[model samples]
Target chain A: MNCIPIMINGLPGNVARIMATSALRDERFSFVPFSLTGEEITQGEVSVDQTTVTLLKPSEREDKINDILGSYPGFICIDYTHPTAVNDNAKFYVAHKIPFVMGTTGGDRQDLERTVKNGSVPAVIAPNMAKQIVGLQAMLEYGANTFPGLFKGFSLQVTESHQQGKADTSGTAKALVACFNQLGTDFEISNIEKIRDPEIQKENLGVPEEYISGHGWHTYTLKAPDGSALFELKHNINGRQIYVSGTFDAVIFLKSKIDTNDFEQKLFTMIDVLTAGK
Target chain B: MNCIPIMINGLPGNVARIMATSALRDERFSFVPFSLTGEEITQGEVSVDQTTVTLLKPSEREDKINDILGSYPGFICIDYTHPTAVNDNAKFYVAHKIPFVMGTTGGDRQDLERTVKNGSVPAVIAPNMAKQIVGLQAMLEYGANTFPGLFKGFSLQVTESHQQGKADTSGTAKALVACFNQLGTDFEISNIEKIRDPEIQKENLGVPEEYISGHGWHTYTLKAPDGSALFELKHNINGRQIYVSGTFDAVIFLKSKIDTNDFEQKLFTMIDVLTAGK
Candidate 1:
């Protein structure tokens, strides 16, 4: 099998660095030396493993793309840039006809999808990139689709806890709350309990001392009207490794789709990547 | 295909009635017309969907078993009896050379397995029998086996809620705690929070009022030592229907094993029934 060339954006971001390190180690992928960085990043380049990746700021990307594409044509872009950069980066990928994977959250999501759906390139976009958690979400989605109103008259409670630095509620939790809503529970995404306090996380939620700075924990509970029955669902993640693993799977899946010229849909989510075979 | 004959014990009880009703509707199995009831019950018969099943008490069961066997010789027994009767019931089934599926909780579980392992009958025994919950448990078991100490230095908290009538902590909760332990979380079964208060279930947990008397809700939370990461798992069931579905599946699985004379391993759980083909 020929190795797929991947241009990983967000050079110095922790998640990007980790993914780049994985790409370097993976035999199926060849890492491109150029990255799309923000204007604020003063560094000219970032080193991942032994490779020095040149950081292409917003102003430099357009000028550099032609030269980079000339050398590593057909390379895919992996985005892990800031939330504000999500749409602009996507528009860039589409205008350049570069197939990409978007791992960044935020931006006007509908507009982001519309940009790809109307463009020439295909992309895999997902707020979460944890395979197992994605699989669980798929299962819940299955339940929601198969048993619509299954929890009719039932009440729902959703609570999510992430690292203190996480500024927004969990996207995965928001997605799952939609599933519960379809299952006939009246719940709002805004109602989801967001816990970011380290002291409360440690004392009340029993978070371990070593990992208070990095985890994703979510719980969704549903109960019958009479308090005669209750159902609770939870998923907790400790670190970034699971996300890295899922992002790579998305890359492999996107490459396969590109290889087969199966681009009729153009835009895909993690669910599509997850349930591709089954 | 020949229909498997099944004798469902603990008739007139809520779970057994539901299972019997399902068995009657299902064409894969023919329901035996007799049930082994507790000695406290004075009723000689119970009507299930127009089928008047004879109730055999302990004193009469010893003699009635021979006659019932004369009629339905290869029938399988489905046990949803009281906790105190779990071990003795298994012994009786073994002595009679009858296959069984035990869904009741609170017996000396190790001894219950030993009895079947030492006997001629193959049984599918599980504490909880909701197929989806069982599938989740199987997934956790896989993780535990594949990544021992994956959660090393993590703290764990287990909470379970059931009907007020339920006298013990959830068997499913206990089983999952064992799995989390294998994953390197230090948690004890005794530390599990047992929630049976209807007010708490409704007011605090948001359990619907109608199902406060008939539900199984469990949550398992694991956190890193430094409180940087967390993972939470939960399963909530509203009624007895899922258990009935799983019980029937177990019966089908056990019958298939018996038909092929695949009795090298005589003990089974809902997990085995679930993953039998996959």
Candidate 2:
């Protein structure tokens, strides 16, 4: 089997380092030795396993991409860059006709989809890349579609706790709240409880001490009006490993889609990668 | 499509009434006219959607089964009887070589499964029968199987609120706790919070007034030890309709299994029914 040539951007970052390491070890893909780093990254190169990957700052990326593409043509791009760079990176990939998998969290999401839809290349973008969490969302989507207004008159409470570094409320929580809204519960996304304090997370929420630096824990609760019924759903992740596996799966899924020239649907979510076979 | 004849036990009970009403209207199954009822029930018959159904007391079920089998030889039995009757009911169904779908939530659950496993007939037994909720549980089971000890050192809190008439804690909650346990969370089922007071349900828990008489709501919250991560899962259901739909699906699934002589797996759960086609 031919190995797919893949370039993982956002090099030298924690998640990027892990992804690059995984790609270096896996036989299904050949890791490109070039990465598009942010302006803040001063390092010229970072080593993953035994391979040295050259870091291309924002200014150097445009001039360097053409040379890199000449050697590794039709390579897939995996982005774990800064949220601020989401739209710009998408435009860059689209302009170069490069198919990509984006696991970044922020940016103008509607425009991000439109960027790929109008462009020639397809891309898979998702906020959360854990397959099980994505599966849970799919199940909720099924509920929302099959039983709209099933929870009418019910109240919802959403609470999410992440590592201190995570600055925003979980995108997964917001997406799930949307599903509950369609199920007849009137819940505002702004009402979500974002727990960032280590003391509160440990004492009140029971987050483990060792994983306090890395985890994603979320809860969505629904209660009936009169006080007789309650429903709560939660998905807690301990580390970033779950995401790595999902990202790899997304990479593989996008490669298959590209291989088949299946461009009818250009923009994909992690849910699409998950339910691809089904 | 041949209409599979089905006997819905525990007539006059709220759940049985709904299941019978659903079966009466559905084209897939023929509802048996007789039901096996408890001895305390004074009523000789119950009318469901214009059809009068005879109630066979526990002692009379033995003699009546033979006569009923003569007319509906291969009928499927659906038990929505009291929890105390779970084991005894399973024995009766197995003794008569009758296939059954047990929806009741009590008795020696292990003994109930053992009775069916040792018997010649097949049965679909589940503590909870809502398809979406069961799907959620299936997702957790996947997590437990795929990532055992994924939440090690984390804490878990399980709370459930049902109709005031529900005398016991939710069986669904207990089953979910078991899954979390396998995922390395040290949670005891006995510690589950059983919120039966209507005041607390309505005032504090946010249960709606209208569904106070009939609803099932559950929540499970997990937190990391040091205060950084939290995961919560919930399934809230109002009214008995969801179970009715799941019951019908089980009946259809069980019927097909029996038709194909697929007795290799006799005891099935709601997860089996939910994932049947897949």
Candidate 3:
């Protein structure tokens, strides 16, 4: 089951490492590495991730991409590099007429999409790559839209537990909070509980990072006055593969839509495609 | 700290055994077997909970109580028996001026209280005996009371995982769910998810039973239409000692609240007793 040939554009970074390692395991996808020239590969000495390669710094990115140009004539460039370089990479992929999967989480997505469109090369991009989590997210989206009357009279508590190394509140968690706020309850993103300790968890009061790291375990509890009833929803994630699998599917689907040549679009956001499909 | 002597009326139940063992290890309390009847000495069969020396027949209760009456004078009775006999034993304690802790769940409460009042006895009773968990419950109670706003749209799913052989839906889980309803939501208790199989959990979700047992793990999640925001609350328990400690405190506290001279004139539940001097 050799995968569709693809060239990974970022191998030295955290999410790229996850993507590269996961790509190696995906039978449906095979790839080459194209290290950016000017980026710093801080994963020093030995990267515990299974991806077999050294990071090529940013100064070498152009030569590396150019160096591999002759070997693979029609390769999909999977750009998981820093967001600062998304626009440049988008232009590069279009100039080479390469379909690409962009998973780098934070970037000026609008600029990338606009550049990809003007250049007319196929691309797929999204924030999270986990499929089941996306399914859960998708389900949440539908639930919120359909059940406008669901959370009436209930006070809400949103809690997200993540690995200790995670520095910020989870973007996914923040997004979910926004969804609930729209359900008519007045809530700020600051209201969410971001717990990162295992010790406090032992107290049975803290949400631990081990419980949230490499996976997302999000729970919401709704309480109402008068103590008459209750509602609770929880999602437990076991690994990061849930995201990887979903992202792969989205990328493949996006490629199919682009390759059909029915529309002259170079790039696509999952939201835009999901919205257009609706 | 030297503690007061107490007679455990339900000599052999799970709760009784745990209490006895914990008491034996601590210097604050001393315990002895006073509830075992003559018939138990003759029959030599231990109760199912392995704490009771014998299951005294209903007709034999009075003689059994009288048999150890003198030596156990001034001692407190810890009742962890069936609720049907609450009135009977409570009356015996009141008549004997015994201060006892009733940890048994459910029985004819009206008659039991009436007898306790008529006899001027003191007792500590609660459906749940865990302090930390109770505190969580208390906080939820406060939240539900303080903020009675309904959420515009929300969904609830409760999954309680327990060790095998726990045949009952967790009373605490149900109580929390009820609290959630008051905080504002609609849900049916019967619809709550109950996962019991360790093999299934390991296979389907890769979670070990050791991660969840001897207590409860509950999760409630609320989401809005756009899947942008979520709210959650969860509780996980590891052992039974939590309940034991609170029950112990409740017992010691109840002992001081009931004035032997005025026991017949007062009726109180654990809330009234546990909240004493708070």
Candidate 4:
């Protein structure tokens, strides 16, 4: 069987680079020699493992993608770009009929989904790509559906700690808030406590010294209205390596769907990839 | 029915004072004018909700107990004393045939339980008295039993934050750790991250400005072996009021149990009170 030709965008970004490196090392996929990067990135290329991939800025991508696509006609794109680029990047992938797996969060999510749903290619779009976290999410979704309003009259407080460089509240935390809301707490996504100070992370959150620049920690606390009880849920990620396997699995899952000619549904989620494996 | 006569101990301690004041306002229980304070207490008496209760230091308790017992014959004692006092207090209660409730944590827990079990007086003993938190505990206990080792191979991290003055890790957090262990992590109680510095609590844990001096926040995070997934549980308590209702309910529940001659079992827990309510 032919290995799926793959182009991983978001060059030089930690997560994208991890995925690009994993794709390069894995025997099942072929890593394309080109990457789509933000205009702000100054590097001409990024080295992943033993291979170096040319980085294309926004100005160069429009003209450069044509030749790259012409050479690798069956190329699949993996996007780990900025939140601001999500929708436009999806449109670009769909316009060129390139199937993709998007690991970025934010951008007009609804617009991105609509663009994919009406487009010619199928794509896996998820705020998170870790298969195990995706499985846990599926479990929470099941709980929300099976036991709606289970925590009625409970007060919810959310706290998330990420690397100091992350400028926004974690998308995973926001998604979990939605689940909690369905479980009966009146929670708003904006109410999430985002902790990014290095000192605070080390002293209060107990984040390790080595992972100070690369971690995601989140906590959700639910209290009974009368202050009689409390329930809490938390997840802490130490580094970017944890996400690689899931991202690669997503590529494999997307390829399988494409091969099966499941073209009617143009969009998929981490949930689809997770369940398909089971 | 006549009000159940009650003596609130641990005068001057914040928790004991809160309970004493609560008992004073409650109509179902008559507050006795006596308290068992630590040896360091120099005050003769402490005021609670317009009532003054004599404070008996450890040196005075034995000599004063006889006189107080004569005045309030059917008095029930509520202990919010020191960890060092738990075992001794239980012995005192058992020796005098005083049916009591012990709300304090620490001490030789097993010895204290055994004292109550073998002694003639019935007692309610619990590490935590928040009804809703107890309820959540019951649910977690259920999960542990029903799904043993459910989180096998998942890495677990426990973090707890309390007021700086707290001298020990939370007994509640310890109990929850046992629950998590049974639910499938090789966690040791000593491994829990205990946050007690005021600055760290406020800045890192996002504790409220007003609650720095009085809060109990706990978080438990579990991650899949490959770091692909994460799960978390958390409970954050502010102020002492949340525990008052559960403590009072325990008093009421103990009195009812005594009234029914259900004295065969001399020891009970918050779990009993919760389920009895249901």
What is candidate 3's lDDT per residue for A1-278, written digit by digit as tens? 33566666665655566667777777887666544423555642234244445456656555666657676665676777876777777777777667877777665777777777777666777776553344345545543554432344557788766666777888887777665664545677888887767564435543334444454556676554432223455655544555555566666666567556744655565544333322
Q: Model 2: per-residue lDDT, tens digit, A90-117?
A: 9999999999999987899988988999
> Can you tell me the DockQ of model 4?
0.13
lDDT (C-alpha, whole model) for all candidates: 0.83, 0.84, 0.60, 0.82
lDDT of 1 by residue, A15-36 (tens): 8998899899999899899999
Q: Alpha-carbon error at B140 in model 1, in Å? A: 13
Task: Score residue B275 of candidate 2 by CA lDDT.
Answer: 57
The TM-score of candidate 4 is: 0.54
Write down the lDDT that model 4 would get.
0.82
Cα lDDT, model 3, residue B91? 74
Rank by DockQ, highest first.
2, 1, 4, 3
- How displaced is residue B142 in candidate 2, in Å? 15
Q: Score the docking of each candidate (DockQ).
A: 0.14, 0.15, 0.03, 0.13
* Candidate 2 residue spans exceeding 4 A from truth: A224-229, B1-278
DockQ of 2: 0.15
